[model samples]
Target: MIDLALNFAFVAVGLAQVLALVRLVRGPHVGDRILALDTMVINAIGLIVLVGVKWGTQMYFESAMIFAMLGFVSTVALARFVLRGDIIE
Candidate 1:
């Protein structure tokens, strides 16, 4: 039963990743695309966490944490660039 649940979660997250990629590609505006990219990052993080849970390992969780930090920083940088045309002084 647990394995079944994990498999279902993996499939759901994979589908979500594909849909987010579609949004990233077909978004009508730059901001929309950026948001879609962020969504994809979030979904990726969720997938990583699920893998960690499935495997009963610590490395996946650590990798997910690092990926999350990078995702957050990139999203903030992108939003700032869009708003101000510059990410740094």
Candidate 2:
């Protein structure tokens, strides 16, 4: 069933997010931490989309888009920090 599939997808995404968080926490390097955080955000978006499909809501989808944009900005900021040792000059 579609509901069962959605549940499975949610569970999988949740597991991935947890692993990504752990990686972020345990990262020995700043770049590793940033990559893990980015992965977590991407997985979160997937989870949101799945939830939206299950609940039949358009708002969730829109929010997921916003989250994606925020994730991109965060990644850029983090990368700049890593490269320049400061987010802002």
Candidate 3:
């Protein structure tokens, strides 16, 4: 059933977020931490989409899109900062 599938997806995404948090905290390098942050962002988006599907709502999907865009920009900025030491040159 769709309800069962949705519940499973929610649990899976939550677990993924937790794992990503652990990586963020225990990462051996700054780059790894940045990657973990990106992974968390992705998991967050997944959770958002899942919520949208579970509720059959339109707003959550739009918010998820916005979050995805922001996540992409932030990830790029973080990676740039790691490589160049400054987000803006």
RMSD of 2: 1.1
Clashes of each: 0, 0, 0
Give candidate 1 misplaced runs (Cα > 4 Å): none
Which pairs of residues have clashing backbones in candidate 3? none
Local accuracy of candidate 3 as per-residue lDDT tens digits, 9-44: 999999999999999999999989999999998899
Instruction: Name the runs in model 2 displaced over 4 angstroms.
Output: none
lDDT of 1 by residue, 3-86 (tens): 999999999999999999999999899999999999999999999999889989888977888999999999999999999999
Better of 2 and 3 by lDDT: 3
Error of 3 at 3 (Å): 0.4
Better of 1 and 2 by TM-score: 1
How do these models rank on TM-score, best leading? 1, 3, 2
Local distance difference test, per candidate? 0.93, 0.91, 0.92
| TM-score of predicted structure 1 | 0.95
